[model samples]
Target: MSASIPQDVFSAEWLALREELDARSRSHRLTGLAVDWLDKRSAGAPYGIVDLGCGSGSNLGFLASRLPGPQRWRLVDHDAQLLVHARRRGALLRDRAGSRVALETHCRSLSPMDRELLADADLVVASALFDLMSRSWVESLVAACAGHGQALLLTLSVDGDWAFLDRHGARVEESEDIAVRTLFQTHQHRDKGLGPALGGEGPAVLASILLAAGFWVESDATPWHLTAGDATQRGLAEALVTGWHDAAIEETPTQAARLGAWRDRRLADIDAGELGVTVGHRDLFAWPAERG
Candidate 1:
């Protein structure tokens, strides 16, 4: 990660966006995947886990509840407000479990305050975060953890590439879906500072990193299909798509008209009750124990 990393992505506005856009159960499809990965990796040892960039602690303490035996669960985030909510959730978890796990919270960006804790972590985890960071940041962090003998499990990497079938795909002819994709992708990298990734293609790239770093990667997936006509899913898709579009246009003004056209068409398709998009995701990774 460079000195210029847009570390400000965790600012108040972005935190609010996460609360709004990330589905309830706080995170819809990825929750179960996260729990499964952590549970299987802990072996018989007590779980020492930290939910990095944990928003509102929604899934943090909840993941702790599923693990039997001793568990030390920590919730961390750069957002102060989110940490307040996470602390409350921690308190609630302590009440229920009688503090069997050391429930803790750290309120600072991982850029500085978290390196120490991360150095001591048994399993470092995140969902939907890798997609939002640059390669340098990820490689550096993974190296740090691997050096410390900790495993990293990250999920919900956006593959950026989307599949729209022959029928609907044909509807996008003339400059077609290509332009919109280019723009949306451009926008994503710029605003998110994901740096040169194919937005949705991030998981595959992360997998390659895990492998090269000597961690055995176990990849699994669950898809979230959103039909815009459905209000809940529609709003999320719209908010995300629109933000992406805006990012794309930030760099290329020529994309303005084309971006508008795509948004309208997609909107119409959804409103007409046929708009659909799949939010792709995959999980499972292990930093296997080093042999003697």
Candidate 2:
């Protein structure tokens, strides 16, 4: 695993892509899954929600829209700029529903140092952030959530696979794109960056973690397929695939030429509107150690 991943995975491009998608009124299916989780757990109680790693308020608005709970909401993230957006979302939520929802935010990257996160949240929530972490970090995070009796609801994790109509194109056995996943996965346990891979094993891995930590975890896989009309979806797909190929070449220059050709073909197809792109995502729900 590489020891140099930035705190925010993909840094600028991922955030930029998210903003563009947000402008298009994109709402991940995981948002509903999270609400469903709480609804079942409501068991006649008001539980708070702490959105861990809430970036750019993309999912926050979704949460506020669906789970209009009077309980506390703490939007936590290391990025101050992103938290600013979260605050704006809170205000918008207030304005739209005219409901006085309790809102608090903590600006800090994910780390063991943030004990307050574990100490306060009844639900430790994160979307699309688990796959970027390592095993050790995941363990610690899980333990903390368990310790706090906080339900962990992690959503939209990549399962080390992609699919389109043509499954052949999905697997890049002979391409540089193969190396990109390896490099990113390498960062999981490398520890200097995004920590270990909490989720490369996909939904099953998360289920195991939550179960072992004493939470009865339930999961619903959401196929986050993207077609041509969604420009941001198309752009993100292109970036991830191309970035993987580029990383592979960075490590092994021997396949540089062929990898370049593969990317050109794929990108060419995408540009020509000859290919279809589809992404798969899954959401996981688990209760606090005590609750289960």
Candidate 3:
């Protein structure tokens, strides 16, 4: 949410770094519900799915094979470069029925989200995206999907809970850590190309909206547990710390020195294989009540 922070967090490198973690953090329970709902649909026709902010098609990759085939996907994102990667990956996927999936990419902003986006989509999905959206935007989306009786699976919405853990998997709490986290959370509520962002309150707000709209909703925690022992996880942990530090500094410039020192200590602990990070996220699956 830092105005100075480059908006390129969606860069291919960053997306790639977090892809595996995202996949593992997704709730199997919510995914299973989504699969069951999709499977119950009439067969022989392609299942039309629209993925909002589909970065490099990670959601498509995670869900395509698990879902029923003859599948047709529309991967949408503002980043043309990320869409390119998504389209390329989509070409290689086959559905649960072993049929090649049909795919298309849309390089467009999700702001002013319209019913047209949900018009042909039987299921609308997005991953790690709702946290960056405003409440009004989400309401518009739920209304659109409900109007079409479309199911929704929104994944990896940060629930604002995170902790640095010690070797024994216990939280390592520090005053500065708390301070940095608070500032980072404040930064999260700032505009992110889409009005004021929902930040950590996304999942709960979305669920409430869905319920009010008469859709059945289910949500589960899908947290990332990164330990320093694994090379890949260690890298992600470091990146997370740096990103948090930058955001915190941007939110409170006066505390830049303190935040920097805190970041350095966290990074050092991570490097020494003495730290682990747990980031809480939520995965939600909602469908029109009539469908349930």
Predicted candidate 3 versus true structure: per-residue lDDT over 198-247, tens digit per residue: 88888899999999999998989888898756666888788888988988
Candidate that would win on TM-score: 3
Q: Could you arrange the candidates by TM-score from highest to lowest?
A: 3, 2, 1
Model 2, C-alpha of 185: deviation from truth (Å): 5.4
For model 3, what is the error of residue 224's alpha carbon versus the real structure, in angstroms, after optimal superposition? 0.3
Worst 10 residues of 1 by lDDT: 1-10
lDDT for model 1: 0.57
Model 2: lDDT to the true structure: 0.60
Clashing residue pairs in candidate 2, if any?
1-186, 78-108, 78-109, 133-196, 133-197, 134-195, 134-196, 134-197, 188-196
User: What tens-digit string does per-residue lDDT give for candidate 2 at 20-39?
Assistant: 43323333444554565566
Runs of candidate 3 with Cα error greater than 4 angstroms are 1-7
Model 1 Cα lDDT, one tens digit per residue, 1-292: 1111123444444444444333331333334544554556636555677777776764464555654436676777767787887777666564224545667788776653246767456777776666566677667777777787776656545556543222242232336556666655554465343355335556777777777878766676644455435566555455555655565566677768977777677666655656655545565555654611
Please give the lDDT score at residue 138 for candidate 1: 68
Better of 2 and 3 by lDDT: 3
TM-score quality measure for candidate 1: 0.74
Two-way TM-score contest, 2 vs 3, winner:
3
C-alpha TM-scores of all predictions:
0.74, 0.77, 0.96
For residue 35, model 2's alpha carbon misses the true position, in angstroms, by 4.0
